[model samples]
Target chain A: MNVKIDGKYYSGNKGETLLELARRNEIEIPSLCYKEGFEGLGRCRLCLVEVIEGNSTKTVSSCVYPIRDGIEVLTNTKNIVNMRKDIIFLLLLRTPNNGYIRKLAEEYGVKAPSRYLDMEREEDCILCGLCVKACEKLGTNAISLVNRGITKKVSTPYDDASKDCIGCGACAEVCPTNAISLVEQDGKRIIWNKTFDLISCTRCGKCYSTEEVLHHIDEQLGVKTQEYLCESCSRRLVGEKFKEAFQNLI
Target chain B: MAKGIVISPDKCTGCRICELACSFIKNDSFNPKDSAIAVLPYDSVGLQVPMTCLQCDDPHCMTVCTVGAITKDPKTGVVKVDDEKCIGCKMCVSACPFGNMTYSSRHEGVVKCDLCDGEPQCVKLCPSDAIEYKELDGPLNKRKNIANLFSDVFGEVAE
Candidate 1:
């Protein structure tokens, strides 16, 4: 099969995906969720490439779509930028807290969708299949997709305690939105911290605890303080936390 | 003896070359999603912050790994994931404060910055020169001391 990528023609196998062909020729294509050895989920949409031939042009996920004979692939184009931006914008809407996705969105000026989709924005699972692939490829099978269609989620079988989980923490690491947190507490391995913390410092006049005050002061001044008072109050409050040191200083 | 990558956010431009170079060198492909180092952007603020494993002296990832798949490289001070030993538990991923660790869909193992064997591709490819690869002890401490002094004198305004 003949494929023209960015005006450069190359001979490729008939069944090969555009990503596979491009990698074989050392041509760079940006992707996030697509891995070489795993099945393509085409969820991240980071590897969308434009194919143009004759008067027809369309954007396709290069990871799943196979390269056809005499097809021309454009890796970078204005239309591609727009499409990618829209896809990324949708992703951002779902997982707005992710710093990595936010960076990509900013790079392309991805605007927030005008109409809200009523989708749950609680977590940032781009559903890229990293967790699922990690389980299947790594032989752990600790995580897999549960449900079908819009209700699908990467989860353990039957939501039961996974017997195959070796506690590698691979699923939590690959999550773009930090939707899953794998934690070890009291000898039990569990996924937690899925909810975003809405806490903000109240900026109360005395919000910092005694220990916090000392720690912050020590960090800032490069000197250890045994007292709990703010810099101004420390001179007066030194009697409680620092008896010997305050006496000596006095 | 373990070397680490130090990123100064003030100098970062969010070019994402670090992500591309890292994924390319480690995985032999150009994909930011596979890269160990992830660059997070605050679009409204026009700020880009590159995050990766600090390979901390007391690493939370290592402490949290139950099967001990994640280990510290004594020579370069990088935390490495042994694919064969990893059970895909995702514990270390949650333990990391900076969110630097990434799970590989292809490898079924959690991946983090290994400093590229002391020749970091991220530092080489970063257009804004936001990242610096250096030894942890002398240069890093010296730089931190300087930053501390500046921050101390200027208060929070130094940031």
Candidate 2:
């Protein structure tokens, strides 16, 4: 189906979201909470696009808005820009110290929300829930956005170390603002207020990953004989075998 | 011939100059954590292996990417992450069994070796000559040469 975006006709497949089509066409639409291959949460509201429907116009979160035949979508009109700016301003207020949020605010020409509101929140988390989504994808469901409204935040169940969390660091890796703190030092990996002993490679004696991660892989994917070896040690074994084979051949 | 970086583990000194060079060239920083190539030191075996993306014919990272952000170019055989489409999901990081794929917090994306755009910094800066950027078939040809010697000695048994 052909969808008109920013006055350009772009062909989009059925069930494709407007944001996906826009991005595929190299059209910029600022979005924070939308993750590819996951259901659109529409929580950020930063990807609002103006949809023109004959006599009426409506603003919809383009990340969730599916493309239709001959649908006219305006990505960056004056109204849409202003709305994006306002959204950025609100995000700035919520995450005053976050670098990503501040960068977005600067790019959109949004002033500091502290000046007008006279109130500043010290929290750096924008509650985008990308981390939560990432954790859920691991099938652990370790963390989630808890509470409601202004008090809502991403946390493990009961604010305790979740046994289900394998300490994969997927949540921290996906966090836009780097809100979730995951620390690794002294052969210990810490995340969500939980500490895990780093597993050492049997061949190399180098600490590589957590014990839980290996156990989870053993249970879920079945165990391999060289599972305990680090990437390089196992790879080096291949080189050694090649050397041995070459010597025999010669 | 398709080019690649081949490592001789015996020659590697575990100096990690490859990691530094790669991180500096790619990310303009000196952090090994952000480097595309990693040197894994095996202290027990007195061996070090410089590991990077293998540019597999069938990549696990590309398969696990939910958003289709990761693709392998058939012409170059380089697997790459499209930054615009990547949502920083880090699924590729977990999916790679060899731990070659890295999730860089600074870049906020999963990054792997692209052979430094056909001029590998790691191979250039490797002082020991353990890491070499050459034709992928170079080692295979050596093996084939030795195999031919066997054929010559056996005089091709009648099949």
For the second chain of model 1, what is the TM-score against the true structure's chain B?
0.81
Tens-digit lDDT string for candidate 1 (A1-250): 9999999999999788999899889888767786555556787888899988789988899999988898999998988877787788777887776777778878777767547533445666778877777656545566887889888887777776665554445567655556677655433445522211121222223322223222322343344433222211321122122222222333
Global fold similarity of model 1 (TM-score): 0.46
Candidate 2 lDDT: 0.76
Q: Which ten residues in a row have the lowest lDDT in candidate 1 chain B?
A: B150-159
Show where candidate 2 strays beyond 4 Å. A113-120, A225-227, A247-250, B1-159
Give every collision pair in model 2: none
lDDT of 1: 0.64
Best by DockQ: 2
What's candidate 2's DockQ score? 0.16
The DockQ values of the predictions, listed in order, are 0.08, 0.16
**Superposition error at B41 for model 2 (Å):** 12
Point out where model 1 deviates above 4 Å.
A11-14, A24-28, A53-56, A113-120, A185-188, A192-250, B1-159
